[model samples]
Target: MRSEPVPAPAGDRRSRATAELTWPGKRVGHHAGLVPVPSPARASWDVRGRLVCGERADSLLLRADAGVALAELLAAPGAVDGGVKLCYLDPPYNTGERFAHYDDRSDRAAWLSTLRDHLLLARELLAADGSLWLHLDDSEQHRARCVLDEVFGEEAFVATIIWQKRTSRDNRKAFSSMHDYIHVYAPAGPKVWKSVRNGLPDEGAFSNPDGDPRGPWRSVPMNVQAGHATAGQFYTVTTPTGVRHDPPPGRCWTYTAPRLAELVADGRVYWPRGGDGKPRLKRYQSEVTGLAPFTIWTADEVGDTGSAKRALLSEFPGLQAFDTPKPLGLLERIVSVATDPGDLVLDYYLGSGTTAVAAQRLGRRWIGVEQSARTVEEFTLPRLHAAWADAPGGGFAFGAF
Candidate 1:
C-alpha cells in the first residue's frame, strides 16, 4: 500500500554501474562482484558438487534436507556486499510429492520454521535497489504475503504475477486451481529493473506493403473520438489524384491537422476510395517493441508441458524425474524483465533450472541452488550444455576456465 521512491539515494555507484552496463557500445559486459569466475571444479565435497556459474556448491535436495539450514552462509564471518539486482526463490509448495531430488512434504511446524529462514536469507542477500520474487500457490500466498510484508516491508510490495501454468483445471473438486503466483517485491523504487519486449507477431505487419522502404506496417484507425456537431465536423479530403471522402459527423481525426499533414507527406496515410472517406494511420512494426506482457503467464504465450518436456529431454535422454518444468519462453521473459545481459540471477528451488537456462539463453550470468544431485548433475547441467552446444563460445563450458 505504501512505497518509498527517492531520487537516486543509492548514490553515484548505482548510476555509474547502470550507465556502464546499458551504454550502447558497453553492453556484452564483464562480470562484476563475482566470487572470481569460479574455479569451483576444484571444489568437491564428499557429496556430489552442484555446479553453478561453472562452479560447485553443496546440495540440499530431499525431504530430510528441505528444512532451511543456512548457518554456514550467514556465518560468512567476513563477506562483502556485492549487489543483487534480482533474486527468485521458488520453494516447494508443500505439494506432498518428491520433486527432482527434494522431498519437501513436512509437517506444518517444520515447514513454517524453514520458511522463516528462507525469507531471512533472501532478505540478507538482497540489494537495496534489487527485488525478490517468491513463487507459491493459494494455499500459502496469503500466508506468505503476510510473512513477506513483514520481512520485505509492506511498502515494498510490487505486483503479484498470476501465471496460468496449465491449459485446463483438474476439475477434481468443486473448483480446481490451475494458476500459480509469482510475487514481486523490491527493496526500493523500480529504478534498477528492466521490462522485456519480445519479438513481433509473425503476421508480417511490419512489411512495406506499399513498398515505402521504411519497413513493415499495419493500418491504424485515425479516428478515436467523436465530436458534438456531427454536421460541421464532417469534411472532404481530396487526394492529388482527385479521390474525395468525408469523416463521420461525430468522429475526429486521431492526429491533428498538422500531424495528419506530416503523415501524408511521409506517405503513411491511406486514402483509398471508401464509404467513410476517412484517413487511417500506418503503424510500422519496426517502430515498436513487440506488445508488452501482462502478469498472468499463459500456455498460449509461453509453452505448455509438452514443449517444456521436449526441451529438457532433447538435451538429456532418459532423464525424466522432474515434472511440470517451465518452458524457455516463461523463464525467458522473467530473465529479460528482471536482469540484464550480465547480471547474476539465483533460483534456490531451481525446479528444472528454468531461471538458469533462461539466463544463459539471454546471455546473462546465473546460479541455480537446488539440493538434488539428480537436478544439478543429471537434469539441469546437461540441458544447459546442450542449449549452448552450437553457440559461438561453445555455450556454457563449465570447470576451471
Candidate 2:
C-alpha cells in the first residue's frame, strides 16, 4: 500500500484538516471538504481515486482534474510522446448559465485565459500528425477560433464543421439557433493527416447489366462542369454506336481524346444502344472510393439533441438530466473520421462521457477528465461500466488529482 496527502482546501485561510489516503488494499481516510470516496476497492474496481503511483495502468483513464491530468500526460515518458491521434474537447460554452455543480458565468478575460491555457497544453499533447476537434456554440466560436489560430498557427486551421443539432424551431425566439460548430486543427498540414471516408451506401444504381467481367458498375456523366473545363478537355468523339458528339456548349469531355480512346478500348466507356444518348463512363464498384466526409452534418446523418437525451435516459435510468449532452452518434462520427481503432482519444470536459462511450464502442483507447465528483460517480463512470459490461473486452481505470 502507498500513502499520499489529500489536496489542501481552495481559498480557505483558516487552519484546515489534513489526512493520508492509502491505496492498493486499504480504505481512504476521511477529510473535511474532500469529495466522497467510493466504497472499499475490489479487483473489478480499478478506480485510482488519487494520482497513479506505478506504471502498467489501463489505457482508459478517468481523471478528476483536467489541468493535473493533462500535465501528467505530457510529463509521462513515451505515454503521449507524439502518440495521441486525436484530442476532442467540448468545454463549457460560457453562456452565463448555472449547472448542477459548476457555474458557466465568467468574465471574457477569465474565460479566454482559461481556454488559452487548456489549448496550449492540448497542443503540446498532440502528435505531429495528430488533430484537434473543439466543439463550441456560436456564442464564443469566433473568439475560440482566434485563440486556436494563435496557438496552432493560422496555417494549421483545417475546417469548421457545422452540425445540425436540432430539428424543430423554437417558437419563443425570433431566430431559432439549431447548429453547433466544430473547429478542427492539425499540428501539421495535409501531408501528415489522413482523409476520412464514409461507408458507401447500398444502392440499386450499381448493377452489371452487361455482365462485365470486372464487377458491378454504374454509369456517370462524361462531361466536366461548365466553368472547370481545361483546353485539352474540349474534344469530339464517335461512340461505338457510330454516333458523333461534341463537348456540350460550356462543358467539356471529362477526358482527353487519347484518354477517352484508351478507356473505350479497355471497355470502360458505355455507349447507349439507341445511338442518341451521350457517352458515359462505367464506374466499377470495385474501383469506387467511399464518400468523403463533408463539412455539413445533418441531424439524420448523425443525431439530434432529443436522441442524445433519450440515449442517456436509457443508459442510466433515474439519473438527473444533463442540460447539454452530445449524441453518441455525433461523437461516433467524429471518432470514426478522426481516428482509427487503438488510437488515443482525450476528452477534457467529459460532460456526460459521450466521447468515452463512443471511443469504447469503436474500439479506441480513451481518456476523460471531469472536475465534478458527482458527475464521475453518478454518470460518467457508471455509463462506462455499463458499456464495458455490454461489450466486455476493454476496461478503464479511474484516478483523481
Candidate 3:
C-alpha cells in the first residue's frame, strides 16, 4: 500500500472554496497523512483468543490505525464505488481524560487534522444516498461541525440529534451533563437522505373501537388551515347522520367535496360524538409505515451509558468494561435509520465493536477498524463473538496489522 497523503480526487465538488476551520497542520483540501500497511493474513475468532480457520466470514475487523485501515479498504480491488451506506464514528473525544483503554489527550489542531483525514476517507466510502453520524460531546463538537461542514458542505447537514446518555445527576459537578450530541451529515441533499432513512416502528398509536373489517386505525383531523384552500375545500359537509357542519373559521376541509363524499361512502370518516359530530379521517394501521424519528432520544427508548456497562459486564463477565461504550439500542437506531439489509457500514473507530454488532444484528455488512490491540483482544473480539453466537448467520474475520 502507498504511504503518502492522498489528495481529493480530480473534479470532486468537495474541493470548492468555502469557509474552512483553520488549524496549524491542516492540509486544506487534501486528505493528509499516511496509512499504515495492513497485515496480509486474516484469521477468524469464535471467542476471545480462540482462532477458527477457513470459515466464510461476511464482515471484518482490522486492528490497525483507523485512517490506515480506511485507506487499505479504498485501495482493495474488490472495493465498490459508493458502496458504504453509513459511517458511524465514535472516535476519541480528546477530553483530556485518561482512561484504562485510551489516552484521550491530543493537541486540538492535530486531533482535528486526524479527524479530517478519516472524514475524507469515509466520504469516499459513502454511497450516493449515504449518511455520516458523528457522535461527540461538548469536548469538540463545535469545531467538529466546522470540519464536517467544510468537508461535506454546509448544505449537506441533516440535523443535530440529542441523545440522553444518562438519567442520573452528578452532585460533584456544578451542573451534571446528561446528553450527547449526534451530528448527521449527508453529501446528498437532506430530502434525498431522509427519503432513504427508515423510521422507528409505530408503538401504541393505533386501535379499532368500531370493529371495522379493515383493521386497527387511527383518526386525524379532517380540516386544515384555509390559507391555501381551494373553493371546493370550503364546502359544508353533511354527515350520514343528517348533521350539517360548516368549514370552521380560517380552516377548510382537508379533502375536496367529492373526495370527502367518497371517503364517507367508504366508511373512512370517524365522527367524534358517536357518529354525529366533527368528522375525522381514518388512517389504517396497515397503511402506516412507522413513526417519524424526532431530534430528542430519551434513555427510556435507548439504553443509557450505565446500562451499556451492565450489558457488557453480563456479556463478558470478569472483563473490564469500556469507559465510554455506546449502548446497543443507540447503534441499532442509527443503523436502522441509515441502512437497509445487506448495505455496508464502515466504522473506523470501532472501539468495542458496537457498530459491527449493531450492523450484524440488523442484517447489514460491516467493516470495523480499531488501533488498540489490547482493547481488540479483551473487549472487541469477545463481545463480537457473543453477538455472533446469539445471532448466528453471518461471520466476521479479524486481523491485526
Candidate 4:
C-alpha cells in the first residue's frame, strides 16, 4: 500500500534488512525495481532479517512486508523456525475501508486478490506440523475458506470455529450481525497443534453417586430407538424384586441382548423397580464421550467489547487502536487451544499486538510483524513494555534490543 519507495534516513537507521529479515523472493513493489523496505527492530536487531544475535526472550516485534514477507521467509526458512509455529492471519476484508498502514482499500474483487497473497505465504511459512487459523467476517469468510481448500487441500480442513464477535444484534440492518468465523486448517501429519481438554463443568446435572472414586457421575438413558422388529431387543426386563418391564412398543434397547446380558450380570445396569424395568446407563464426568474445546465462543466466554476496551486501557489508558480489537482473554483461549510454550506464533494483522503479548504472558515465544509502525509505536509498544515490566524472573530490556 506504500506507493512510493521509502527513502532511507541519512544516519545508521537506514540499514538494509537481512535476507532472513527480508524475503529474497522477487515481488513487484509499488515502485518499479524498488528494494524492499526494512523496518526498525528493537529486540533482535537486524537491518532487515539478518540476526545480530543480541538476545531473544519470550517475545519479538518483527517488522516485515506481508506482500513480500513470505518470499523473504521461504528464502531462509531455517532461520525462521525458532520463532514462528502457529500463524494467525486476518487480511483486509476488502470492504472498501482504509486500513491503518495499507491504504489501498478494495471492493469485492480486490479482497480475493489480497487473500491469495496471504494464503500463499502461510502455506510456505507455516510449520509442517503447525496449523493456520484465519480470521474473517461474513464479508469474506466463505471466500477465504474456498481459497484455503485450494491451498491446504480440502481434506486438511479442520473445524470452522464460530466466534461470537459481538453480543447484541446490531439492529441497524435487517439481519443483525453478531458472530464471526475462524477457519482452522492444519498440517496433515505429526501435528504440532496443542489443545487442553477443557475441564468438565463443576455444576451441571451431575452428582457424586456410588462413590465410584473417579469423580462425579450422571445418568444418560441407554435406550436407542431402532423402530420396530429390531433383533434381540424385544425381550423383557425384570427387577431383582420381580418387576417386569418391556421396551415402549416402537422403542428398542440401546444394546443387543448379548451385551445387555453382560451388563445385567456385571450389575452395571441401574434398574429402579428391578430387572423388569427400563434401564438407564451411568455416565461419569471422568468418562465424558470426548473432551472437546468450546467452538461456540460467546461474548461472555471470551470477553465482550466493553472488556476488550478495558484491556486496551490496561495497556493504553485512553487509546483504542481499531474499532473492535479482540480481548487478550480471547486470544489466550485461542493460544491455549492452538499452541504451547516455546512455540512460535505470528499475527499478520497485528492491530494492537494482543496475540504477541498474550503469548509472552502465557510463556510461548512470539514474533509479531505489523506493517504499521504507527500502530506498533502508538498501540503495541507501550503496553508490551508495561507487560515486560510485569514479566516473571528478570524483565525484558530494550537497551540490549
Candidate 5:
C-alpha cells in the first residue's frame, strides 16, 4: 500500500505540517500524543501521519484521527472501488459522557450531522455485496434508523440485531436498559449479501441409530402444508411395522409419489418400528450446513459487558481507559456473519480495537480508525500489538491523520 499522506484540505491546521508521518516496520511502541493545531478556516480539526504496512508485512491498517476525515486513506489508489466487505462502527452514543480524549456530548442536529457525514462516506467504501453494522443503544437508535434509511435507502435495510449487553437489572431505573441494537444495512441491496449461519453446539444430536453407512443423521418431518401441496404430493407411507400412515389434518407428504418411492428405494426414509410414529426423511449430518442466525443475541451466545471488561483487563493488566469495550466474541460473530477469510473489514470507531483483534484472529484483513490519541496509544494499539505477537502471525501499520 502507499505511504504518502492524503493531500490536506486547504487552510486546515495540518496544512502547515510539511512532512507526513509514516511508520513502516514490524511493530513499535506507542508514541507521544499528536499536538493539536488551530484551524483558522474551518471548525473541524486535523491530525497528520500515514501508516502503511507492506503487502507481505501485516494484515492491519490503523489510522488515528477523526474517521470522518480519512476516506481517502481507506480507499487507497488502484484499490478496488468498493472492496470493503464489512464496515462495523461503534461511534459515540451521544450520551453526554466525557472520555479522557474525546467528548460524546452533542446536540441532536450536530450528532446526526456527524453520523450522517461519516455514514455517507462509509457507504461509498462498501462493495456491492458489502454490509454495515452500526452499534448503538436506545439513546439515538430510532433517529439513527431514519438517518440510515436516508443514506442506504429503505430497500437496503437489513435486520436490527438486539444484543443483550448486560445480564443484571439496573434497579435505579424503572426498566433496565440491558440491551443494545446493531443496525445492519446493505448498501447495494440485501440480495447481494451472502447467507450467514451460526455453528451448532455439538454433533451429538446427529446419530446413526439406524446403522446406515451414511455415518450420522437426523430426522425431519415429511409433511407440507395442504395449502401449498399438489395432488401428487398426497400419498400414504407404510412403516416397517406394517402400519400405514397418511398425512395428518391439513398437511400432505413433502414429496411426490415418485420421489417418495425413490427415497424409499434408496433407504433414505426413516420408518419407525412403533405404529404410532410418523415416517420422517433422514437428514444426514454431512448434508446439513449450519443454523440460521436469529435477531436476538443473548449474552451467553455472545458476551456481556462484565465479560468484556474482564477481557480488556486481561489484555492490558493495569490500564483502565475504556468503560465499555465490546467483547471479542461479539465482533467475531459480526465478522463471521458478514465477511469471509481475507475479506476487508473496516471499523472507523476503533475504541479498544476489539474489531481489529477479532478480524485478525479470524484471518481477515482489517482497517481501524480512531480519533483519540490516548485510546490509540494506551488501549487500542497495545492490545492489538499484544494480540498479534501472541498469535501465530499478522502485522499492522499505525498512521495519524
Candidate 6:
C-alpha cells in the first residue's frame, strides 16, 4: 500500500476563471489516474459484544483509499446513490508536515485533485437534501471553497462556519491562528437543504408569566429595520392599557397595522415593563422552532484541540495520539444539524473515527473510510468499541481492502 502522497510533476499553473481550477495532472473525472480497486477482505475481529461481519451492517468501517472506495460504492448496484444525508470531511490541510498515522503534506495540485474527486463522488452519494461539511484551515480554505463552488454549484453553497479550534495564543508566530473554517455545501441547493436542515436545540428559558392559555412561551422582537418597509408598517401600536407607541428610529414594526391588530387580538403580543414597554411577539413553546445554528462556534461550546487530545489520552493511556483529531462535540453538532435519527452519515477521511463515534451515539448510521488499516485497528476500532459499549444495539462491520 502507498503510504506517502503521489507527487505531481511540475507544469504551468495558469488558470482560467471560466475553465475552473487548472492544475498539473488535473483529471476530468473523479478517479485519480488509473486506481486499482481493491477487494474488501472479509475479516472479523472481536469487538467486545458487537457483531463484526462483512455483510450489511448498521455502520461500516472500510479500510481502503477513500477515492477508490467511493468509486466502488458509486458503482455498486442499489448502493449509496442519493442515500447519504451528510458527509463530514476532515481531510488533510496540506500543511507540508508528516505525522504519525499519515503524512499531512502533498502537492497542491494532487491535494486539490484528490479532494475534488472525493467531493464529486460524495455529491453523487448524497441524498436530495444531503449536505457536505468540510473542515479546513486557512492553508487551503479559499481554494477549497472555489472547488466546492464549482463542484456543488454556486447556489448550493451554504454558510462558512468559523470554529474556534483553540483559545491560547502562539506568541512565537506573527499571528496566533486559532480558528478553523467549516465550509458547508448542499448538492440540491441551499434552499432545498434549508428546508430539511435541523436546527440546534433551543437553550432559551421560556416562561408564561401572564398565565396565557398557550402555556409556556417566549417573546421575540417585533421590530425590524425599515430597509424596505411599506408605509402601512409604520403605524402606531396601542397596548391593552391604551398606551400608544410608534416604531423606533430606523426601525419598523414586523407586521402591517392590520396584521399587528390581528396578533394583538389573538393575545400574541407581549408588553414589557408592566404593559408600558414596547410590544413584542409572544411565541408559544409548541410554536417555537429550534434556534438557528450560528456561523461562529466557540471552542467552549465545541471542544478544542487541547480538549480533544486530553480526551484521547483519557480514553487510551500510553497511546500515541493523532496529530490532529476533531472533537466529538464538533461532530455531534454537525450530525445534529445535518441529519436525523437513522440518516446515513459518511466520512471518507475518517482519521481517528470521531465522526463514526459521534454519529453512532446520536442514533445516526455512518460509513467511515480510512486509508490506514493500522490506524483503524489501533485507534479507530478501539474508540468505536468504547462508544458501542455505551450505546449498544447496532454493531458495525469492519473490512479492509
CA-only RMSD, every prediction: 10.6, 12.5, 6.1, 11.3, 11.3, 7.7
TM-score sort, best first: 6, 3, 2, 5, 4, 1
Ranking by lDDT: 3, 6, 2, 5, 4, 1
lDDT of 6 by residue, 1-401 (tens): 11233232121111212336768988864344535343443223321113473233778887878987777676565545338989999998998889988999999998988888778778778876678999999989999998887677676777999999999999998999999999998766666566677788777778989899999998998999999999988988887777999999999999998898889889999898888888999988877667778999999998999999899878878889877888999999999999888889999999889999999898888888999987888789888887877876567877666
- On a 0 to 1 TM-score scale, where does candidate 5 land against the true structure? 0.80
Candidate 4 has a TM-score of: 0.70
lDDT string for model 1 (1-401, tens) is 01343244233221212111121222131212222222232234212223332332211121112222222233343221354556777787777776546675766545644565566565666556567888887666766776666555555667788876767667787877767888887756433332321332435445565787877777777765564434333456666566665555557656666667788998889764543445777777767654545677787777766677777777667766466577788778776666656555656677677777777677665545566665667776665665444322213322211
Q: Return the top candidate by TM-score.
A: 6
TM-scores, all models, native as reference: 0.65, 0.81, 0.87, 0.70, 0.80, 0.90
Please give the distance, in angstroms, between residue 353's alpha carbon in candidate 5 and its true position after superposition.
0.4
1 or 2: which has the higher TM-score?
Answer: 2
Model 1 TM-score, all chains together:
0.65
| Per-residue alpha-carbon lDDT of candidate 4 for residues 1-401, written as tens digits (9 for 90 to 100) | 11233232222211221221112242432223333333233225432333222244434565455655544445542536643557787666655566544553665555665565566665666655566788888777877777666566655566777877767767778998777788887654212232221222334477775665656777667666766546787777666677766777567778877887787676566665434556777666666643356668788778766678776766666654454567887788777666656677877677677887777777666666666676667886666676655654222322111
Each candidate: what lDDT? 0.57, 0.72, 0.81, 0.60, 0.71, 0.80
Write the residue-wise lDDT of candidate 5 on 330-354 in tens digits.
9998988887777778888898899
Per-residue lDDT for 346 in model 4? 76
- Candidate 2 ranges beyond 4 A from true positions: 1-58, 191-205, 226-228, 273-275
Candidates 2 and 3: which is better by lDDT?
Answer: 3
- Clashing residue pairs for model 2: 48-398
lDDT of 6: 0.80
Residue 7 in model 4: lDDT: 34
Candidate 3 per-residue lDDT over residues 1-401, each given as its tens digit: 11233233223427432677798978845554544344353233221112321255667787888876776777664644447889999999999998889999999999998898888888877876778999999999999999888888887888999999999999998989999999998877576676678878877578899898999999989999999998889887877687999978999999998998889889999988866788899999887766678999999998999999898878778877788889999999999988888888988888888999999888787888889998888888877877777776667777666
Error of 5 at 256 (Å): 3.6
